[model samples]
Target chain A: MSNFNLKVPTMASMMANGETPEILFWVGCAGSYDERAQRVTQAFAKILNHVGIKYAVLGTDESCTGDPAKRAGNEFLFQMQAMQAIETLNGYKVTKIVTACPHCFNTIKNEYPQLGGNYQVIHHTQLIADLVADGKLKTKDNKVFKGKRITYHDPCYLGRGNNVYEAPRFALEALDADLVELKRCKQNGLCCGAGGAQMFKEPEKGTKDINIERMEDVKESNASIVAVGCPFCMTMLSDGVKNIDNLSHTAVLDIAELTALSNNL
Target chain B: MAIIAQILFLLAFISAVTLFYKNFKKILRNIQLGKSISRNDNKKLRWLMVLKVAFGQSKLAAKPIAALMHFFIYAGFIIINIEVLEIIIDGLLGTHRIFLFLGGFYNFLIGSFEFLALLVLFAVFVFLARRLVLKLKRFSGAEMTAWPKKDATIILLTEVVLMFAFLIMNASDHQLQKLGQAHYPIAGWFPVSQYLQVVLPTSAQALVFLERFCWWLHIMGIFAFLNYLPYSKHLHIILAFPTTWYARLNNLATLDNMATVTNEVKAMLDTSLVPPTASENATFGANDVHALHQIQLLNAYTCTECGRCTEVCPANITGKLLSPRKIMMDTRDRLVEVGQNIDRNGNDYVDGKSLLGNYISYEEIWACTSCNACVQACPINIDPLSIIIDLRRYAVMEQSQAPNSLNNMFANIENNGAPWKYAAADRLNWANNLSN
Candidate 1:
């Protein structure tokens, strides 16, 4: 996977050259460390690079957006992390942010304004949709996923949480593939069981895991590829498919990965 | 005899209204027990939410069959009550069909009321069947066990009896008018209830007695139902409007930031800045009902107990102990208990129990994924997720108790700037082999 030499720019590197990128690519905690999620980060970064979009990653300067802490009821810790991230972002005079993680996208877009760190934050799917709409990213020649059955799982934070339901679907629609919808999609989408800090702790006693129940919807959809926009959903849905029987055919791919693969970026 | 009858009617009306007012005052006081938060901004948007959600029954559209049935009941409850005005005037003035002056318009009004009553009866039957026969999963939960279960049945049965009384009253009245009874007037039309005229006795005296009996039952039932609103989940009929109006306009992803915590953290970051002083016994989050915001208390009162929140809840669907409906029910129950405590002991007295552990168990609150499905499913915008977060706050901040895994995650966030324990310098390792 590392054989491909892709150009990735950092905010510090851009600053040293007296350059300001068009947007800041916020490679979130999952995108930075988690091996599986890092692929999504690279895929999205590949799309940005291919599109000739000037974007810079915060790299080591970026910290956790404190969504998990806030949701887990550690307000003090959340504010501490948020304040530090806000100060760093403000210091760089950053105004526009794009991230592959819905959790980071949501926390920055909605919750940051209250703490005096305001910016034009968008999910990477939204940015990708715009790029396709502007004709910067061409999907017309794409044949890799043209006839494949793809179902999109709406990430809770991106869909019901902030009403960004169409952007990801629009990106998937560009693949020229047979885009199917899960039984529970858009506003009524079910959780992938990795939210509210549940990703950190073991779920309380239950007859089944929430992800397994969501996987049932995926099974019902019968789509060969399950497209997700959030890193957390990617991990949860992947684990779900592996755990469930007769689901090995289903590949959980992020919207960015699908787009990048289809475009041969 | 007519004077005595009027006096009795006046006495009943005054007492029913007075008792309802007293109970309503107690509810207001109980809500006042909660901490204050400003939901007063954006008045125009708030009113729009009230109209769209409460009056329009917009959110109920998620389940079309249930929404249509509820619309029938809601419309019947509002429109049929106009006939009650005529009944009250007739009782006081010893007049028969005082609205007869409206001529054909009175007939049109009464006809519409009769039609609505029939629809209400049909809707009630369907609702009853859904609960008892069909056994909808949404209607059955651990919280819907005894009193909550009976409460729903009782309200439906009450509606059935009241609707029957209304129709029979119209039928007997129609029969009396045909007999040329002295006090009977040929006034309103009966469309649906006209069929019931066949059930009436032929004798004028018998018809008069039956008419009077049904009329009294219908009026008395309305009064009883009014007073029952305070104790029953039926209170949503009144509270839904205000609850929708005060709903959070912000995106569901935005959890409210604690200003006090921000101040404390600011002081920690900058030594020169002084943190705001807290009360001697200030708590981080809601351990008791009084610690919650007033709107959150209103949300408890407005919960219809339809179990829609619990039905859509991931935690509950996965067979976890957490049910969002139970959270609202427990909050209301605790508030009621605290209200009773205040009435028994003085206002300052504590019950030595709280909402967190006393009613909602740690296992239940801990199971939530905070996915906002429960929040989205609430028809009237009642926020069970907010209450769950507050309870979690009490557990984490006030008690310093959390799952061991969460403790490790928290430590990682503090030390490594991410939830996972990875060195900050290596965050860019994903881009190591990339070409510039």
Candidate 2:
């Protein structure tokens, strides 16, 4: 499925050679499977590689964090899946993890502690912001998005669920783009209609779709690009944008992808 | 004459209590139908919750005007109970103003009662106006049909009549005392009642009969109110304390994990520990009211049908079918139906219809975002989301009737360890052109 080569190590291979990476790169289900989301996964991985951070994937071993199942009220399936993932992570003695998907980031960071899988989990935006703050990663003056008005869509899980708002904004701010805030931003931000496992089912018919309502906010901001943090928001907001006839030129992307593109990674 | 009056008073009191007891037993049986859950821990905290939320009316204070009006009605109802004690003593002993020994204090007490009765009457009028005249949005909805609407009006009118009876009784008694009638002691000044004296009849015989008629009407009104509580939303006056005490103590945002399921899952993780064998008839979530926990059933009863939960729900705000207020109302309706069926056909009665389709539809439950807005908005801490989740669980696990997309997702998670259609071996494919 891929052509160009990159030296990516697996946790199993690293552990076999008696080595431990500094962080575990959790390529979540969507990151691995969904085509549009895979681009974000690549963009974030490039940032880590360009910054010279040692990270390994659970390659062929990682599973879903059971977030969707738990939210859908399938407790039995959620538990069975979660326990298996926990056992694998605990076996590796991995203590730090970074992921681009907020759903994975939230479930593993918040819910896994109750399931005996405790680790220092950071979203990719948080990790990139820290790297930039530490002078480990420097952005070049590529200005592809400079002076362009870009709006940020906060994922429900990462924003309201865990209260991580500024890190993603900081990552975007580094791109020199004119960051425009939606009317309902931060704590008051509306969902992209894909939370609570809604991404896995048809929305109940309503007067207005939540994402379309949210897209109205995006359009009102007059931003050509909609920067999102979660893969689900990317899918929903992109679909929302597609349904609007006049917004053909508008782009929906993750913060990591925006960062990678702006830095010419 | 005194003995006969005492006998009649005892008989009335017993029958009133007996009718109230019969309804109370039915409610107790309905609550017992739900599965047991432990809310017995953290005694200090639960009591504090009851004091603050129920007794203190802390949540109502969010709406300042409604809060002030409710405070008047609530304080009047409670403080007026002290006067009921004196009434009971006088009725049992055939005495007049039995607590009059505390002469000046009795005057202070009676004066406060009269003043509070006026405030209560004014508050009740305001409430009636909001319901009938202003037609507040929260009070008008599909769930609030004829009975619930009329029931509210009936309670307010009853309170007004009872307060009127109390005032007229005191006014005629004051006139009798001034006339120096036998056993009519000159004890206390009731400012409002004395004001009411100008409107009383001048004849001594007419005044005595008026006083006696009002006294009987007031006591009998109280008895009717007591029995009516079990069948009306006013049951909140009695159930709110216990409901708040047993409220779920988790953060409003936190959904409780089923402890039994968690334990079984933990056992499944450790192969040496044997997980309980799956029962063929074991239903995952709630299909009927009986699958819900006892606190949930109590929550259904404690709902004042205020519609605040529905008012704040994101699903409802977005014009979706889901209304959190309706969920509680439906649960309570189904509970009453189940209780009646059991009363008629023993405990094993099969009604054939379940709560899922009969009361709440799948469309309403599925529309929820599980955002906990309803829980945060609920004044009495009723959790409609818990019931919603339980019903969703039943939809997914028991019937395997989840939406097609969800079925695909479950299959993906089962086969590929994720909710997407991709192999884990290719997970690192995204990293391939990244380091070039």
Chain B vs. true chain B: TM-score per candidate: 0.98, 0.94
Q: Show the colliding residue pairs in model 2.
A: none
The DockQ scores of all candidates, in the order shown, are 0.70, 0.34
Question: A1-265 in candidate 2: lDDT tens per residue?
Answer: 2335677788999999999999999989888888899898888877777788888999888899888887787888887887789899999998999998888887788777777889999999899888767866555466788789999987767776677889988888777788899987875667787877888888887787877888888989999999999899999899989887688788998988887776667
Off by over 4 Å in 2: A1-27, A30-60, A95-115, A118-192, A213-265, B171-199, B202-205, B256-274, B277-281, B429-436
Candidate 1, residue B394: lDDT: 90
* CAPRI-style docking class of model 2 based on DockQ: acceptable
Name the TM-score of candidate 2: 0.82
| Residues A19-82, model 1: lDDT tens digits | 9989999999999999999999888888898888889999999999999999999999999999
Deviation from native of the Cα of residue A160 in model 1, angstroms:
0.3
